[model samples]
Target: MHQEGTRLPNEPVLKQKHKKRPIKTLFLEADEDHVAYQDSTNRFMKLVYVHEGYDLTQPRHQLINPHYFTGNYPGTDNEELWTEVLDYIDANYQPEQVYLSGDGAKWIKNGAAFIPHCTFILDRFHLRKYCKRAAVGIAGLDRTLYQWVLPGQMKFIRDYFTVRFNDLTVTASQLQSLKQAEKYLTNNVSAIKDNGLTAYHGCSAEGHISHYLSRRLSSRPLGWSSAGAQGVARTRIFQLNGGNITRFLQAEQRQASKQAKVTKLDRRLHFK
Candidate 1:
């Protein structure tokens, strides 16, 4: 019997290149608060990840992932919590770019250093909240000014303040108020600029936090178990990532099938 050498197919093999998935930029918002437990205290850190170009018409806005870390609030070692959270993000998502928004907390600023590559933005609504409180408390301004300025009236307020802040020679009281507002604005200028374009009242991140986490946690004076709190927070993140869970699952399944097929083929060719 003549042994025939196997020849590769003569037909032009079409190498269909897989199109690269578009790079997604994620907006990350995080906050840590102490949650009371029955016998002890738990510090819960929540992260909300939002991607650009995600369809908002779905049930939840395009939340990519939600992560929660809970532990006993270590006075000075809380930074470790931030490090763990950053490591989780880096491992799971591998996001192209991250934009962080948060209330002006010292821990938030300090923790952010862990993810130095991320674009840190202050929570704009928090900035306005501080400004309004200062306006009323220190400047002796009325509710009307706060209401108007908290909305998209920042430009008008800034212009008005520009003239007013200059004209009124810096008195002790005025100086105090100006200093307060200045500090808040200086720290949160980027968040304000990014959010000011919107006609809405509050920062989107703040709204998400209130709706998703705060409403449930702050509804009544209640204690939560560390595991239970972490579970709920994690679930909320998945919910916010929208209905894309199905798509993600489907993609994962397809990849697994493809990998399995390759493995099976390799085994067949190499079998003794």
Candidate 2:
């Protein structure tokens, strides 16, 4: 068992480095799960993945060779996570382009700067959310917002909201909602436009969070220590990546045994 506050090292799922190959397009998606610590405070466990588009044969489209990284990373560690992702890309496949989809979080966008030939695409979930909230009063407004987005005419939506917010008749609550939606749209203008690009595949970060992180970490009634949470998350990802937990454990045991014997031999030689 890990001591309280201890964090397990973030380990990659691959035992051996990927054999380099060429891929025309790669998709990267990221999201975070808010989990409760034992003391009741919450921490965001961020998850990021890279895949070779999707497998259409599956009833539900499946990612092809998705590898994940998860942790309660903050500040510099967040950069490290993205760096590791870039390293993985460089080591494995030579992709002509990489599309990163997320909710326009600053950390997620930072990845665009770190990786070459990377473009940021805002996920539809957050876009729809802001559109709904901003369109609370008008019937069909949500649909209208999405329509404008589809054709890449974000300025129409912005101008419409700006005109409405300027009206003295609008309520304070309505104005607040409009301002928030506008802010989100403005900050992610490039990402929003990139969504229409043919190379961009849709994002399933939320679904992944539910399946990979929330199922064990937050969906339950239990609170976890820092170490326990990270451990469970890593182990879950390992299994999802087709790792056999039993084999991994047995390998770890053998490695530990060898290390122990080496230590013992060195101590005996030193005493003599």
Candidate 3:
């Protein structure tokens, strides 16, 4: 936020339910192996990967794998990354329209703004999930809630939550969820309204992020150093892109060998 070109932050970190705790988690004590106080951007890790697919059921992320950035995630890196993706798309394919979908994160929105003629869609998966969590909280007091929202009774379900919210009967958890939903909706009201009225495809980035990045880097009891995390993330992304992992390993080995020789020369000069 202190940087020159940073637009005002619009992403909600306040109520985000993430695998790694909030940025405040960076304050803890760490043993010699790891660093204390981790944020969304930095972690150390490793991975061994196999191929993944984007089938007919979930095809939006077919061409590109999730690109992981380690250490600090800066806007410059994001801009350059998005530019590379766009250039790749333009080089190989013809498209009638290009639409960008994300979790209403400020960085995602900011990046989308730079692309010419990009249509921004608030990801349906997250929108629905947050609304559902909020709705359940709103109706937590209703014993007969199961009967109130059947497959064809979505309108009733929506109204049920609305009425409960108005009545001030929501539980604490529901209140937080409601706040999240409201902020998300308020921030992207136009998108929410249009989404309700229009027919559009669902987004699979959430699932993709979980499968490709979060599972490997953020979830469970695992922790990461920035370099190890980035090295594995790069390798995973390469595998997803249909690149040869063996070749990548070989290149890394050559680079490492050259760097080791340089370090050896430096040590000899220092000792002399």
Candidate 4:
């Protein structure tokens, strides 16, 4: 009821509207909660999404309800959060291969390892983000190869920059920047042009974050406790996934009324 915006478009709907369709692949995305707190302790929270059935061949899927987990939880590996992500996909979507693309964090890499049949594609959005920072070293090739960059031509670009760099007599700093840029690109060459690697092209995390989470939670000035934060997140995600809040409340009331009747019957029998 306290939602900020007036225009929440329940517009784009998932393909498997009725019957379940086996997912060919899925994309995993994790984002941080900027204002996470546990009673003013300044704790951290992560919002992770497991979305499937979005490939270049087909229409993109709607936002699947996300899984929210608190960071620094007890009794788990570092990959605990992502492990849960894999589990969520297994239970619901049953995709054949999960195409993972996200931050190049150790934990994210480890998540791909967790899934046996997972293909790790360095999401172009994140890859280009780092590329931009390191691009200064590559003679600002990002500007020159603007179109090529999106099409997954980083290897060609890298080779061109290599030759260009060797010819130029530059300062150590410039050389270091070039080397850094080259290494970053070289390491992620396979992930470049991921659309060729898989039917689905890019990571939709940025857009989803804006539409689902940030627009309501972070962009506004609302504060939340650990429970409150997680609650709103789960609620909003469910709404995005086509859940009706009114029907949900009615169902809860019905269940509560049924439980009360059962309790009264048990008490009457005991008294008799």
Candidate models: Cα lDDT each: 0.54, 0.81, 0.45, 0.59
Worst 10 residues of 3 by lDDT: 24-33
Query: Candidate 4's residue-wise lDDT over 1-272, tens digit each?
Result: 42411222222223444444577766676545455354555433455566643444446654444433323222223566666565556556767777766655555566678876777676666666656655565556566554555566776777766775876666678668667666666676666656466466466666766666667567766666655655566567656556666766566679899999999999999999
Error of 4 at 142 (Å): 4.8
- Clash statistics: count for each candidate: 1, 0, 6, 0
lDDT of 1 by residue, 1-272 (tens): 00110111111122354543444455556565456666666565444333343355777554433434433335543566567666555544555666666776666666656664565666655765666645643455535544544344666566645764676555777667766765676556555565443321222655655666667664568787655555455445544434234454466679899999999999999995
lDDT of 1: 0.54
- TM-score winner between candidates 3 and 4: 4
lDDT string, candidate 2, 1-272, tens digits: 33311333334345585578998999899999889999988988889999998887898888988888787777733788887788878888899999999888888888877888998899998888888877867877888887786557877987888788878888889888888888887777778877778767689999999998998889988888878887788777756666666666677779899999999999999999
How big is the positional error of residue 237 in model 1, measured in Å on the Cα after superposition? 6.8
Indicate which candidate wins on lDDT: 2
The model with the greater lDDT, 1 or 4, is 4
Q: Which pairs in model 2 have colliding backbones?
A: none
Best-to-worst lDDT order: 2, 4, 1, 3
Model 2 regions lying over 4 Å from their true place = 1-19
Which runs of model 4 end up more than 4 angstroms from their true locations? 1-23, 36-45, 50-88, 91-94, 135-198, 267-272
Candidate with the larger lDDT of 1 and 2: 2
List TM-score per model, in order: 0.51, 0.89, 0.56, 0.61
Error of 1 at 167 (Å): 11
